[model samples]
Target: MITIAVDAMGGDYGPQITISGALKCLEMVPDLRLILVGDQEQILPLIPHNLSSFVEVVHTDQWVAMDDKPSKALRGLPNSSMKLAAQCVAEGKADALVSAGNTGALMAISRHVLQTLPGIDRPAIMARLPVREGATYMLDLGANVDCQAEHLYQFAVMGTAFAAANGHVVQPKVALLNVGVESIKGNQQVRLASHQIAQCDALNFIGFVEGNELFSGKADVIVCDGFVGNVALKASESVMRLAVDKIQKRLSVWWLKWLGLFLKPILKGLARELDPTYLNGALLVGLNGIVVKSHGASDEQGFSNAIMQAYREVSNKSNDHFEAIMDQIEF
Candidate 1:
């Protein structure tokens, strides 16, 4: 059974959404076991008595608040739910961890507790975004604001390995997120990183990509600093919502209403593809342990999706698998 540690008191709904989602995931994956870390008083009552065999609860007195600063959580609360969940992985009690907690706190405590993988200076948040070719892996989604060219190289290598391991792509094209495809378009950092990546035989670096090509499937791995990546991610999501609303309103017309009904299956497929909850986990890649971050406001479907992601990573020993590939690349 794949063991997954879950911060049950992390998200907005805490035990309500997380514990429910854990139970739902257990029902889906019979070989999966979960360690739900939270306050006993808040979590125990929610779990069904019969599930005590598969689902274990670890009680902690503190929880990292949604607004708690990373430094404060790291310095003040050593035994928070988030910390204990991460500790399970550090101590080998759990194979992977999932949390819908304070993103900064999760990152900070995870780094402090688990440390970074060999030769990695920092961790980057990588998420699979829907694209023409199914999905593209984008990294540094609000993890590191200020990054060096070497950091981008690490993201490139790790992102490439991730695409191959999970996305089932061979020689996944890696690109530097820049103003244009030309080397002259971006700032010094991107241009320098591009040249270095091109020199590294381990990574399949494909020069630069513009923001517009983000979802065009031009590159399987898109590398950028957290500021640009976070903004672009949010903007694309906003645009997706706007486009969906407009399409729905347009289809509601008297003549098109029947056509829309006839294409309901196709529409539902599109909705699933675009649904954020369907692909809710973000990898804290470069950390020593496998850590997945669920959206703080995620519901059962989304939180469970995150847990499933942890399960897959644990089942495949993805972190160790990727590390083998990473060993080939020199940053």
Candidate 2:
């Protein structure tokens, strides 16, 4: 059985959304067991009747807040739901962790509890980026603000391995994100990382790729420092919001409203692909355990999607492949 430890009081809505999402996950994942870590009094009432076999509640009086500092969370809150969730993974009592809590605190506590995999200095926040064919995986979204060339190279290997293992892509194309595709373009770190990654025979390391090609399916994995990757991700999210709002206003017209009756089906599918809920899980790879971070403000449906993602990784046992790939990295 695949057991997932969930921080039941981590998100903006706390027990209301997290507990609901965990139950939703159980509905879809039959072979799954969830350890909901939070206040027993709070979580017990939220759990549905006659599901004692599937869901186990681990009581914790402390909870991590969104505004809590990473250092403080790690040093102070020993029995917080988030801390217990990570501890579950560390103790091998859970196959993975699902949390919609403070990202910094989660990372900090996860690192302190689970520790990074051998030869790994830090964990990158990697997530699927929707693209032409299906989706591409990008790393260091907001984990490390500044990364060395070697760090970028490590992201490439890990991202490549993750795509191959999880996305089922053999010889996944990996690229370094740059302003231009030219070898000489980009900062010193990008150039150095590109050269090192290209030398790895195990990876299908293509040369530099421009930002415009991020969602063009030009590469299965794109590697960059956290600052650049985070900025790009936020900017794209903003653009998506702007476009969606404008389209909604435009379609609110009388004639357009009539047209929507016929276009609803087609529009719904498009909307699903573009919606943040469809791609809600951001993985913290390179740790010894599986840790998926859901968007803090995600609704039950979105948070449940994140849980499903954890189920997939846990079922696949992707960590073995990821660690093997990390071992292959020279630096």
Candidate 3:
């Protein structure tokens, strides 16, 4: 059985949604075990007595708020639920750590507690975004806001490794997110990154991808610094929500209303498919163990999927493969 440590107190819904998600996941995967790391008093009551045997609670009074600075919180409260969860993974008690907390806090704790894989300078957060052609895995989603050229190159390598392990085609085409497709269109950093990515042997480094080509199904892995990646992710999410909302509102008139009723289930399915909450979680790549970061507002489904992603990472031994690849890199 693979054990996953979940930060029960991290999200807006607290243990209720977190525990509910775990229960749903348990129903789906029989071999999964969960360590609910939070205030035991709050979490234990939310879980069913029957499931008490399968789910273990790690008591911790400290909670990291959404606004808390990652470094200070991790240093001041060594036993914060998030910190403990990462520690559990580091100590071999849990195979992975999943949290719907502050992204900075998760990255900080993972780095301080779990440590990075050898040859990895810093960890990057990545997510698989649904595109018109197929899903594309994007890296540095928000881990390192200010990154160097070498860091972007490492993100490409990590994103490639993740895509391959998660079933993307061999030697997935990797592209650097840029203002334009032209090689000379971007800033100094992007130009440097472009050169470095082209030189890397481990990745099938494609050239720049302009904002317009993001959803064009041209690349399998998109690499960028966290600032650009985060902005792009947020913009995409807002656009999706606005579009869905408008469609639903427009469908609420006369005969169109009946179509809305008939398409309700389909709409719900589509919403679920495109929901940012569904993709709220991100993988902390370059770590020795699997650690996923979820949105602070994530609900049960988001948390559950995060757990499933962790399971996939552990089962695939992505970290081990990534480390091996890094060792083979010339730099």
Candidate 4:
């Protein structure tokens, strides 16, 4: 059985949505067990009696707010639901952890509690995005805002490993997010990182990829600094929402209203496909165990998907496989 530690009180909807999502996951996956970390009073009542057998609640009095600084929050509120969830994984009580709290706090707590994998300098948050062709994985979403060339190389290595384990492709094409495709078009850091990545024998280095080419499906893994990656992620989400909203508005005319009603389901399907939350959660790569970071605004469906993602990581032993690949790479 795969055990996932979930932050029951972490998201906007609190334990209600989180518990609902976990219950949904229980229905979807038979072997899944959840260790729900939060106040028992708040979480227990929300969980159904039938699900009581599948879920074990770990009580905590405190909760981490969305705006709290990760470092200070983790230090001050050591018993926060987010921290305890991570601690569960660190203590071997759980196979993986899923949380929809402050992104920085999740990353910090995971690093402080779980530490990095051997040979990894920093752990990166990698998210999978649905593009025109298919899903593409982007790394360092908000883990390391500023990174060294070696860090970028490590992100590429880890991202590729994740893509492989997720069955994207063996030796997935890895690219650095830059201003242009040319090797000489990026900043000094990217240029240096590009050189280092090209020298990595274990990776399928595909050279630099610009933001425009990200959805083009030319590469399987795209790596960037946290600042750029976060901006890209947020921008993509905003644009998708705007486009969808505009389409719905334009189709609201009397004549087009029927068409709009007919297309609503199709559009919703597309939106769900593109939504980052539906894609499970971002993996905090380089950790000893898998740790997935979900959006703070995520609903139960999103949380459920994240739990499924944790199950996949544990069952596949992605961390061990990643370590093996990193060891073989000639850095």
Candidate 5:
């Protein structure tokens, strides 16, 4: 059975949303067990009696706030739910850790507790973005802002490993996110990283991918520094929201409302494809243990998706695969 440790007191809604999400995950994943770390008083009432056996509650009243500084939260909050959840994975009590807490704090505490794998200098945040065929995985999302060429190369290796582990793609196509496709287009770091990634025969380096091509299904894995990646991701999400809002406003018209009824099915499918809930989990790859970070503002359903993601990673034995891939490389 796969066991996941959850920070049940983290995120915007606290235990109310997290505990409910944990229950939802249990319903979907039959062989999964959960360790909900949070205040017992708040978490207990949310859990049902029948599902009690499948979950273990680890009580803690403390939790890292969404705005907490990474360093402060790491040095203090010794018993915070996020820290304890990470510890559960590091100590082998759980197969993975899932949290919808402060991203910086989660990374800080997770790195401190679990450390990075042998070949990894620092862990990168990898998450899936909607693509025409399916979804493409991208990395270094808000982790290491000022990254070296070697860091980007490491992100490529880790991102490729992650995409392959999903069982959907074989020898996933990798591309460095750049201003343009030309070799002379990108800055020094990207150019160097591209050359480094090309040296690995195991990686399918397909040249550079620009911002507009993110959802074009041209590349299976896109690697960039955290600053660029984070900005691109947020901008894309904003664009999606803007388009949705405009469509909704247009559909509110008397004539367009009638047309909306006819297009309801198609729109629902489109919504599913673009929904952030479906793409809620982001894995902190290159860490010694699995750690899935859910968006802090995500709802119950979104949090459930994050838990399921962690379960999938555990079942896939992603860390082992990643380590093996790294072992084949000289640097």
Candidate 6:
């Protein structure tokens, strides 16, 4: 069975939603085992007796709050739910960890406990984005705001490994997000990172990609500093929401309402594809162990998706593949 430790008190709704999500995930993956780490008083009451066989609870009264500083959590809250969850993975009690907690604290605690993989300078947050062809993965979503060319190159390597591990992609095209597609368009950092990626035969660098082409499916892996990636992600999600709202309003008209019946299937598919909740989990790549971070405001469905993402990584033996790829690259 694939075992995962979850921070049962880490999200906006704490055990109310985390427990629900864990139970929902149990229904989806039969061979999965979950260890819920949080206060017994809160987490135990939420779990149903029928599903108790597949879940184990590790009681802890403390948990990092949404506004807690990273440093404080790293040093002060050693027994917090988030920290204990990471410890489960680090100590080999569980194969992975899933949390929808404070992003900064999660990063700090995971890095300190699990540490970075061999040859990796730092860890990065990689999230999936829906594209025209299928889905594309981007890294450094909000981990490191400033990065060097080497760091970008490492992100590309990690991204390439991630795409290939999905078992569908072959030699995924890697690109640097820039102002324009032209080589001379971006700042010195982008140009230098592009050059570095081009030299690595292991990666399939496809030159620079503009913001407009983010969802155009031109590249399977997009690498940028955390600042750019985070902004682009939030902006793209807003645009998707706006588009869906406009379509709903347009269909509310008397004439369009009649036609909406025939277009119901198509609209349903579009809404599913556009919903950010469907792609909520963000993997903290380059770490020695698997740690998937769900959005803090995620509901039951979103948190369940995060758990499943961690399961997939473990089943695919993704960390072994990532280490192999990293070993092949120098600097």
lDDT of each: 0.86, 0.86, 0.83, 0.85, 0.87, 0.87
lDDT of 5 by residue, 164-215 (tens): 7776688899999999999999899999999999998889999998988988
- Output the worst ten-in-a-row residue range by lDDT, candidate 1: 271-280
lDDT of 4 by residue, 250-282 (tens): 998899999999988887777776667545877
> Relative to the unseen true structure, what is the C-alpha lDDT of residue 173 in candidate 6, on a scale of 0 to 100?
92
Residues 1-331, model 6: lDDT tens digits: 9999999999898999889998998999899999999999988888889999999999998899999999999899879999999999999999999999998999999999999877678789998778787778888898889999889988998899878777558898999999998888988888999998999888899999988888788889999999999888887767766776677788989988877667667766665555443455889999989999988888898899889989988999988877776677666
Question: What is the TM-score (0 to 1) of candidate 3?
Answer: 0.94
Clash pairs for candidate 5 = none
- Which candidate leads the pack in TM-score? 4
Expressed as tens digits, the lDDT of each residue in 109-191 for candidate 3 is 99989888776799998887777877788888888989888898888888887777666587889999998888878888889
- Give the residue spans of candidate 5 off by over 4 A: 261-272, 275-278
What is the lDDT, from 0 to 100, of the residue 57 in candidate 3?
A: 91
Q: How does model 4 score by TM-score?
A: 0.95
Candidate with the larger TM-score of 4 and 5 = 4
- The root-mean-square deviation over C-alpha atoms between each candidate and the true structure, in angstroms, is 1.9, 1.9, 1.7, 1.6, 1.9, 1.9
* TM-score, one value per model: 0.94, 0.93, 0.94, 0.95, 0.94, 0.93
Name the better of 2 and 4 by TM-score.
4
> Would you give me the overall lDDT of model 3?
0.83
Model 1 lDDT per residue over 1-331, tens place: 7899999989888889999988899889999999999999988888888788998899998998899999999989988999999999999999998999988899899999999988888899988878886678899888898888988988898898888877477788999999988768888888888988899887888889999998898899999998899888877766766766677788899989887677666755665556443466788999888999988888898899999888988788788778887776676
Q: List the residue pairs that clash in candidate 3.
A: none
The true-versus-predicted C-alpha distance at residue 248 of model 1, in Å, is: 2.1
